[model samples]
Target: MKILITGGAGFVGQALRRALGNAHTLTILDTAPAPADLGPSTRWIEASILDEAALREAFAGQQAVFHLAAALGVRACQEREDIVEQVNVGGMRAVIAAAVATPSVEHLLFTSSSEIYGDGEPGQIFREQDEPAPRSAYARSKIASEELMAAAAASPEGARLSYTVFRLFNAYGPGQRADFVIPAFCRAALQGEAPVVHGDGLQTRTFTFIDDIAAAMVSALDARAPAKAAGSLEVFNLVSEETLTIASLAQLVCLSAGERPRVLHRDHEDPAVGRSKRFEVTRRVADNRKARAALGFRPTTPLSEGVRRTLDSVRAGSGAAEARG
Candidate 1:
């Protein structure tokens, strides 16, 4: 299959590149310049997803499109909702429009975030059917994008565009950005600084490895798209069963670095901290049974192993750009 991944220069996109390997012809559309190690079968297009002409040109001759380009991170989204709206929401509109106009594009897969299922009750595992309670602007943008995708598929113009929405949980791995929890903890641990915890530190999240996320996403290509009442669409929670508190993850990262755990608790809402008060997801976990049965999605990396590898990558001077993706 000929595939096009928007924001393919990022960490998760690079993992998807590895997973796809030479099996498919891959084209990347991103604002970032092409990486030094571009694959033999991959082509890089340094363009923004919000550019309709660029999207139309990129969508040409592609069988599948992975929509991954967006303004990521809770803090970033909270700080600049304007840019987030432009990239996440407006960019999605461009992608959808381009895909609809393209004849060769059969499938459109979007990388939605698990943050949409905000503030779940204790032990509340989220399903695709669960109602979304988005907290931050980022989460709201994702929800809006998902709705747009669904609407496009259900529309008469988008009859040929079958779509999949992969609501990915906390993704952490070797090349991830330090802004995320795992890499941040590892970096702090290596630097002999206290692991910083936002909010009460008791907030829980299920971390999925980058490799596992890529695998699940690729598996969706071969899986059957069951008919839905709404449209020719499928939604899966690409997550692992491993769940932990923010405080525990910090401790784990510190211990993995062979140091005693020292945690620094910070107010997520403090203006001095430069974080959004809307970072309100107290507990976020997902039910991956649908993905397991439908896409054979099984996350193998344990949190300990993942943290160790992330630490190693950080110590080896892995750049932040890769992680930010």
Candidate 2:
């Protein structure tokens, strides 16, 4: 398929490029110019998603669009609300508009977040039927974007566009930014420095591997349209069934680093403060039944194995950095 992926230079984008390189013609659009290492089959365009003309140009002749570009990172979004709103919401508007305008585009996948679930009860797993109670500014922005995409899909103009929304959980693996929990812990542990654990480290999360996420995305893109056709919009939760506490994750990182490092419990307040203590994702386990029934989606990697692979990649990258220095 001829595919256009926005934010195609980011971590997940890089993985997608590596995974789909040989099979598909790929074009990447980002605010920054294309990196020097982009593959020969891939074309890069320098433009933000907010630019309607640029987005239109990028959408031309593409059979599918993967709208992965967004202002991400909880901490970063907490600090820059205005920029997050503009890039996350405004940019999505432009992308959806361009995709609907282009007659050749068959499928458009918008990457949403599990944070839209906000603070659920500790034992309850979030499902598609559950109401969204967004807490943070970032979550609110994502919720807004999802609504926009749904609205666009329902419109008469969007009849030809197939829409799939993925509510991604905590995705971790190599090439992820160091600001996130896993990478941050890995870097600190490797340096023999105490890793910081915020908020008593009791928060539990389902960390989805990057490879699984990419696989799910590909499946969602290729799924057949439903027969009833209320515009054929589907939402899937992309995640692993395993839920690990932050404290346990920290210890695992220490073990991976081959060192028992100190964990400093910082008093940093959660952005979703006073909202809820524990999120009960009882159904936190992704009911891949919907996805599997529709698009042969299955998560193959175990959590421990994925973590080991991530640690290995981090160590290798660290070694490279040391050699360069």
Top candidate on lDDT is: 1
Per-prediction backbone clash count: 2, 12
What's the lDDT for all of these models? 0.87, 0.79
Candidate 1 lDDT over 1-325, as tens digits, reads 9999999988889889899889999999999999888878888899999777788778889988999999998877888999999999999998989888888888889999998888889778899999998888899999999999989988999966679999989988988876777888898998889998887889888999999999989988777432322248889999999888899999999999999998998998766667655566788988899999988998999988988888989987745545776
Q: Candidate 2: where is the Cα deviation over 4 Å? A: 225-230, 269-287
Alpha-carbon deviation at 151 in model 1, angstroms: 0.9
Candidate with maximal TM-score:
1
What TM-score does candidate 1 reach?
0.93
Provide the TM-score for each candidate, comma-separated: 0.93, 0.91
* Superposition TM-score, candidate 2 onto the true structure: 0.91
